[model samples]
Target: MADILTVNGGSPLVGDLEVRGAKNLVSKAMVAALLAEGPCRLRNVPEISDVKIVSGLLELHGVKIDSTDRDGELLLDPTNVEQAHVADIDAHAGSSRVPVLLCGPLLHRLGEAFIPDLGGCRIGERPINYHLDVLRQFGADVQKRPEGLRLTAPDGLKGTRIQLPYPSVGATEQVLLTAVRAQGVTELRNAAVEPEILDLIAVLQKMGAIISVETDRVIKIEGVDRLGGYDHRAIPDRIEAGSWACAALATRGDVYVRGAQQLAMMPFLNVFRKIGGDFDVDDEGIRFWHAGGTLNSLVLETDVHPGFMTDWQQPLVVALTQTTGLSIVHETVYENRLGFTEALGEMGAVVQLYRECLGGSPCRFGRANFRHSAVISGPTPLRGAEITVPDLRGGFSYLIAALAAEGQSKVHGIELIYRGYERFSEKLDALGADYQVG
Candidate 1:
């Protein structure tokens, strides 16, 4: 299949659609199944490439997976879990970071694990240093190997207190997955409490792990004698919901997004209203649309959970280009995330990249000289042009920009978009988009 899309722009996307489980949480929940002896059933899992990657990795490790008659559901049994060949694991885990997180559960099951170098989106440098450090504190012996990294726990893992320099979502997940089954109690400071992370905690709790979250970014996990399985429903994807909302705003369209919850999206929803986009919330989902007036521009800064999500910034930046005034976006999460704005500039958007922290307060990138900030000035009519998808969120941003533009755009590298988005082309067709798959 060709990874290309030719989109004829200028019309708005107006329709109803549904988003499945959070891709960020679903994959981690699938990984959580490895820690269970009984079969764990996960519902509302999105059909995305990342799920396939994690499932393949689990299958290579001898987890028996069977599907139900219902759509988007899986029963994963880790009863006969065994070590997978490093080469096989590497081949299955291409472009995914879940393999590293598997080390703890694999060690608990098999006493040793071999993990290949991780690969993920080109958003920023997401180091596994914190993961390795936390694993070591839990008594796993980490060694560099030719294939990748080998972790062994001969004396068995015992929990220990750990501190994180930054409240990273990945590192926090690593801690939770490893600390759940270790020997004693573990305390972690500066842990991430994102909605996805909290949902992951709920899944682990269902699997018989005792964990508590404190308000001051602290988490305590007490190791249990045994572990069972869980029947869980994953949280709705706020990132995908916000992306669709931005798509509607960018194209001056109306979209009813099913499964978009209000609580998790409160920060994003506030920003949406501030930018002059209107949304109505109900029990099922959210209805987002343009408000028939000039859209306002404002300052936005991305931070950890309870703040504007870093994932929401890219597509909204595209929407901001249709706003009335200047919109300043300070990307404090990933240093090079603003690099994708170049394509919008090519499409006649006035996006200026800057090295300084331009939104509210200075971040770590202020001294690193990375172009981590953007200023978008608009109400400028966009003209579609040839573009290549940069990464997952950035790829969706390209689609929004193309739909909001005048001419046609040939979007290359669209296969990367499937890594996170589930049946995106079908949804585009459902929303009456003028696009063709090549």
Candidate 2:
């Protein structure tokens, strides 16, 4: 039976909370550990579903992984990794993009690798064509099989200059992982410069990989003969931090988010400021509060990295419903992301979907049948209703909507939130939220 969370709305969340390692970076970093010899120690890891899936995959490949630590640290010993279990690998490949990331590292460690289907937020058609194309360019023999993708590097990996059609995060990570052990230097243009990617690069550098980052979206990696074990702490989760900030605004409460960095969330901080959500940053974490004032409407667009992130758009959209004026949002990352807006509209939010590109260039969402542009008419009274979580960030949006609504709300598929959030139900309870798991 699927677990559900029943929330009684009209309660404000208060008190302090701490965020751990990023869900985005930690998973790929686990896969990166497979590329190096000996044991690697990772600290401040978040206890999320995706991380568990990665740990399981590493153990299936004969890597020794221990999750019994109190602080969510993992020690991965990859020296004994022999055969990659296809059944175990294939089961989770379609659940997250991290499995696809393992393809490069596995091929580097053991000449052949099979990657099952890839999965993540159901926002768009995340095709691995760009990743496979880059892998083929690097001299890896790739073939599509009925079960999954089979890749072999007979002559080992040879580096080549690669330019991405779009700055896809997964594809960029794939190139970085594959090219690190390839022959000669690999230059990647139009690379994703997300903070999580930067953190992964930092971990790789600690493992004795020579890599440099340039301003023009160029990444250069020199092929290294062998990589040593690395011990590093991951960066704080910006997405979780942003979600809490939005939750604070939606409920008009004060919350101090510990372990959250301000620099990583500058774009979201700017938007929160415009929306009348007051926040202050210190060395430890960020503090969010909503003073007694009118919430304002601001235009938003979701881009890759350094731009407003696609994941932050959903939860913030729920907070936008409390704004006094009309709010315009353009989603550039995923096509089916607007499905959550329909759920919000059910709770009395005046959100209209548009087919035409209201934000200039053609977006993936607009290109598809799913509406990318949303006009939110707000200060509307929201009433709670039963909702199902479609994806990760969308699940948080439902939680935000439930928190802001007038009555009781039943949120099904609460497990989806566990894919990224760590002890989310417990955290909500700590914040004085009226929610119970059923």
Candidate 3:
């Protein structure tokens, strides 16, 4: 049975909250540890469901993971890792993308890898075709089986130049993992340049991998003979930081998001400023609050890294309900992302989803009746209602919607929130949010 969250609305959340490591980075970093010869120590890890999934997967491969650190530090000993049992690996195939990332490192170490199916946000079809194609480019023989994907690098990995049709984050990580141990130089074009990717590269460099980033979205990696383990700290989660910032805005409260860098979120920070949100930034973290003034509507489009993130759109839309005008949001990432707006509409939000490409390019969700564009008519007062979370970011948006609403709200399927946010309930309580687990 799914866990439910009951939130009593009409209370302003105000306090300082700390954010741990990036969920996106930590998962990939855990998989990256498989490439190291010695044990690697990771600090500032978030105690989330996805991290546990990756840890379990690593233990199945004979890697020793000691996660008893009270401070969220993890010691991963991959030196003794053996061929992982396919059946055990297949169990969590649909959990997250971290499993697919294991294919590369495992293939390099053992010359054969069996990867279960991959799963993540249901925004669109997250195909591993790009990942497979990149693996094949590196001279790995790939075959599809009913159980999972089987990959073999009999002659060992040989690097080659490959270009991605789209800058997919998972595919980019797959290439980085596979190419670092390849025989020669690997050139990857259209690579994702997100901060998480950069952090992964920093970790890889510290582990003796030679990698360089070039203009025109190119990443070149000269495969090293062997990689030594290195201790590293994961980057702060920008999505989690942004979620709390939106929460503060939605509740008309004050919150200091500690441990997150402001420069990493320039696009969101710019929009927050345009929306009349006040903030103060220091070396430690950022503080967010709604200034006593009319909130303005600004145009937003979700794109790949450096673009307005698609993940941040949903919660920001919830905050936009209080803004006194028509706010236009064009989602360029996933077509079906607007589905969350339906639940918002049920909570008294004046949001309209449209199928006609309001922005121009044909989106994956546009072919069906799924709308990619949203027009939020606001200064509409929202009333709380029962809602089910559709995905990770959508769940947090529901929390923001509940906080902004007038009556009590029951948010079902809240367990999905652990995929991203860490210490969410305790942090919410610290902010004076009246929420209880059910």
Please name the candidate that would achieve the greatest TM-score relative to the true structure: 1
TM-score list, all predictions: 0.99, 0.97, 0.97
Could you tell me how far off, in angstroms, the CA of residue 295 lies in candidate 3 after the best superposition? 0.9
lDDT of 1 by residue, 98-174 (tens): 99889888888889988887888889888899889888988999889888999999899999998999998989999
Model 2 agreement with the true structure over 1-438: per-residue lDDT tens digits:
257988999877898899999998999889888898878999999988888888888888888987674577998899987667778788867677777677788888888888887777887777888988998999899988898888998988998999998888989899989988898999999999999999999999999899999988999999998998899899999999999989999998888999999899999999999999999899999999887689999888888879999889999999999999999998888877887888898889999988656685446555556677889998888899999999999999999999989999999998989999998887897799998788
Q: For model 2, state the Cα shift of residue 285 in Å.
A: 0.5
Evaluated with lDDT, which candidate comes out highest? 1
Residue-level lDDT of model 3, residues 202-266, one tens digit each, is 99999999999999889999999999897999999999999899988888889999997987898
**RMSD (Cα, Å) of model 1:** 1.0
lDDT of each: 0.92, 0.88, 0.88
- In the order shown, what is each candidate's alpha-carbon RMSD? 1.0, 1.4, 1.5
Model 3: worst 10 consecutive residues (lDDT sum) = 357-366
> With candidate 3 superimposed using the best TM-score fit, by how many Å does residue 39's alpha carbon deviate from the native?
1.0
Worst 10 residues of 2 by lDDT: 360-369
Return the TM-score for candidate 3, rounded to 2 decimals.
0.97
- Residue 82 Cα positional deviation in candidate 1, in Å, after optimal superposition: 0.7
Candidate 1 off by > 4 Å: none
